[model samples]
Target: MTRDGRRGEAADDPVDDATLALLLEVAGTPKPGNVDRRRDLDDLRFEAFLGGAVGARPGLERAARAADPGAPSVGDAFVRAVEGMAARAGTNTQFGCLLLLVPLVRAAADPDRELSPDALDAVCRATSVDDAVAFYRAFEAVDVAVDDPPPGADDLDVRRGSDAEPALRERRATLRDVLALSVDPTDPDRVADRNAAEWTEGFPRTFRAAEWILTDEGPLADRAARAFLGLLAAEPDTLVASTLGAEAAREASERAAALLGVDSEGPGGVGDVDAIPTDAVHGADLDTAESLAERFISEGINPGTTADLTCAALFVALRRGAEVAP
Candidate 1:
């Protein structure tokens, strides 16, 4: 529950380090525009894998239900698509793949509009290979940028061995393992690595990225929601007046806060708020997270709960296989 990384400027703004890695890789590959090139949204069958997981996210299933069977909302389409990815990969995952297909999901939901290219740009601007090389070069220009912590900086979060140099070697080892070949099969952090790898070959972006973004995060009732948002907010049309509105993400955020006995914004009729359990420390997978999520949805969703429902559904789809970090 400790805050991770720096403040993100905004949800659905641009790709963070994670998504950017996927995007830049896609852009460079033989199939940069493949997701876009697909003629129709439903024609893409990745939805079957998503199944109930998509239905579990906040707003996703309701949007699909509201839209008529052959038709689904952007949120609905995205969650289902991620479900499909998980099912196909033959593994458990939260389906963060939903993020990559955001443009496609929004486009499918909106018969009136095509998801814009800006979403892709948001990812590309951060990486794009050419930029990465420049970034590394820039880092080289700075002096005293040693991989190891200096004398007084031992208090830094970085782990060190007998001394700093050995620690740098260990750091490199971690990166290497995180970036290792697919013979072990589970790891693939950067984009360039996926293409060259033996096992991750020919898989959709959903499966490729979901390992870290969704599954590896560990399971806690809260994470299912985070995974869903990570994927849904990627949709081209998902960016709204504000991500902090009374939507699924906000509701999920509130639920997480309340569980921790923190402040939550809602009507005066406050219901029973469950205390965070000791086991929840192990995270979502260890908890009956999906069921708790369903309870959260039932209590919070009213007639006008379309947005919230869809968001939660998306969350379920993305985080299904993920776990909370220990």
Candidate 2:
């Protein structure tokens, strides 16, 4: 029970945390080069995205329920939810977010509500080969852009879409196994996005983002915006790096850090530096962030990985009993 003696969760409604966070994420303005209340991509509209998120609520809830101890494997929930969402949205709106949130929702909805690192890892580790197949099926349902497959991995080609499912079965690869192979440890030249890395490392960044959201103040959207910038500033967006290049992604992160007047090193690094002007974003002015957003959109630079992290943070916040802003 919450302090108000009501059942504690993201909301009282039947809708689950994944759907709610997705809705809130798309609705957040000044999100920088992503579709939000303030802007929309030429091919996608804000309302369409909102409708898609709401439409996927049932599947997200089911996925959460499926994650309960002794219940069915939870990975299929992601595939079903994404399939349902693709049908509704007609595009790749929330695939990455879905990937991050399904496990979180499962952990949150546990009978004990034991939302912890260990619990989340357990949920991820429990995934089966069926979950891996479902994940590829979800990929087939959308046109999500990603880096090219490393050489010598013909069956792992994501572009193969559903065709890759058969190969997955032959290898008996689970969702975790797929992620492990996504980023080759031997290749120093290759880079994996935080999302993919999370699957292998047990989602440290998502949990850390959630922890930041819990301690953050201000409206949820503002907190989300800040978190988004922080994530980008700290790490180059893998989606951007893959679709564009490593240098482009690094520049995007540097620009975000400059806008927020923070650095990858630590908080308030820019402000504390004597060289940067006092008028710099020491206070993290909202207008400066918006300005950076406009520049990013114009430059065709989208920090999608950062946005995914924000949604993960929002899910963590809502799940941990932080009151949502009206």
Candidate 3:
């Protein structure tokens, strides 16, 4: 992979798997409000996502080459990936996914360590203040919908992008520290930052959903679709909450839970239900899912965060030996 838009030689590589995961995630049909093979959003088309995936290969390769002395850090790789992705897509396509995948790809580069929560956590914990600055720079490369910063944290607003770099440097914030700001919110109404939570908390949802994708017996695309539904049902999408409201995000999850015939609520609260049963996911009512997809798109509700998590899960599954076959 080169900046000149030429692909490297094909071989067994985690970068290839990561790129495939992006394609499979977008290709999965009836992803409900996402641009999948069967449908496209008004502003974003399916082709852009394909171009984004192809364009992101250089950054993925950089992350996978962590052993190289000159390899970019996780945050630098992420910034490169987002810049490439936006350049090809003409907008943001997988910003959140690359945030998750960059560290995971770096963790996968360690021959002594398997791609696991602990491994990823170590990679995230090792990030420096420079990485935090790079992360903010990545945000400057594309438009990402994010909530306003908390009242006292105006200087740390992510939407400020690179403008906040001085504050981050002054505070000596690492990339993990920057993500931690979004993980535990003081305001009850603030939507949880699921991607940041994954970065700070070792990617629990991503790994769990990867297990769902691996255990389910089907085509890889169908497995990804099922995993996508399970993920959407399990949590209020952060993007939905930011774009719409918390109530709208919860309603979307509730509808997905209903389609899966599961309770959306549990002892913990909304989106704390048990793992969606494998049987239920495999036997899910596609007709109802399709109808829900139509309804969500019509209402301008897109579960973009869930889709990002699903793409990360697909990458994990692919790394763990989930094969794609006809």
Candidate 4:
């Protein structure tokens, strides 16, 4: 169903689904340290996200036109989307979300393919050095919160933006190749880049959480908030790690896991939201989640990478026919 409760009206339109996903992600309240309908960070307003979603549509349209002749490549679409999103929001609002969405949108554009991890993987793998250059240009559009590159990879640092273009060309790196660098942590104390991991590892968390959202009954916004919590609890947020260190990121995840009444230990490791029974996340859990949201906001511990994953999951859920009725 569409946002207005119309079934199948825009079901075939990946651009519409992707745009709605962005709006719905931010609309989910108590998302904990992220912008939502009921809360705002000091630097980012709820309205800014709305503007970013609107601005991203043209690029999404480009992605959805992938089967057509002269269509933009995945990285080109991503760069255009990031540029438009930043222009409208006056800052970087959905850079990470666009990073995930563009490939999924491109994959969904193919008439012969269904949107899945394998399809997304193929789309990512097909990118070229030109795509890598376009991706680096996206970094110059706005300030994205990413960790510094590992030792001796300074020429490939994302913050170098277009300046890294020559190096990327010299190395003949594809967009996937650039993303591969951040997929895993170099040290025991560091947290892996969750967004990059999704890109290189076929979006395991996004697909898993999308299934969670689709199967659960309730308003989509509430389901999104729950999925947000689940993804955050499952792993430490990469953005949190970049800004607040690995320990602080783990602490945030543990706190979320505790709110869901799950043991933060054992085989799945700490804060596995999947371990908690589905029905257990109600009433008291939500109340505690609200409190946690407030605390995370006050402390400036935003789990932004988790939010980005939730947005990608929402896109998948929408494409899979998750109802958007209020």
Please provide TM-scores, in order, for all candidate models, with all chains considered together. Answer: 0.23, 0.87, 0.94, 0.94
Error of 3 at 298 (Å): 0.5
Show where candidate 1 strays beyond 4 Å: 1-99, 102-252, 260-291, 299-326
**lDDT tens per residue, model 4, 142-250:** 9888888887789999899899999998999899999999877688788888888888888888888888888887888888898888888778888988998988998
Between candidates 2 and 3, the one scoring higher on TM-score is 3
After superposition on all CA atoms, what RMSD does each candidate show versus the true structure?
21.7, 4.6, 4.4, 2.8
Give the number of colliding residue pairs in candidate 4.
0
Model 3: clashing residue pairs? Answer: none
Per-residue lDDT, model 3, residue 12, is 44
| lDDT of the candidates, in the order given | 0.28, 0.70, 0.85, 0.85
Cα lDDT tens digits for candidate 2, 133-199: 7777777788887877666667877678778988888988888877776655355544465687777
Candidate 4 to truth, TM: 0.94
Q: Estimate the lDDT of model 2.
A: 0.70
Candidate 4 colliding pairs: none
Q: What is the lDDT of candidate 1?
A: 0.28
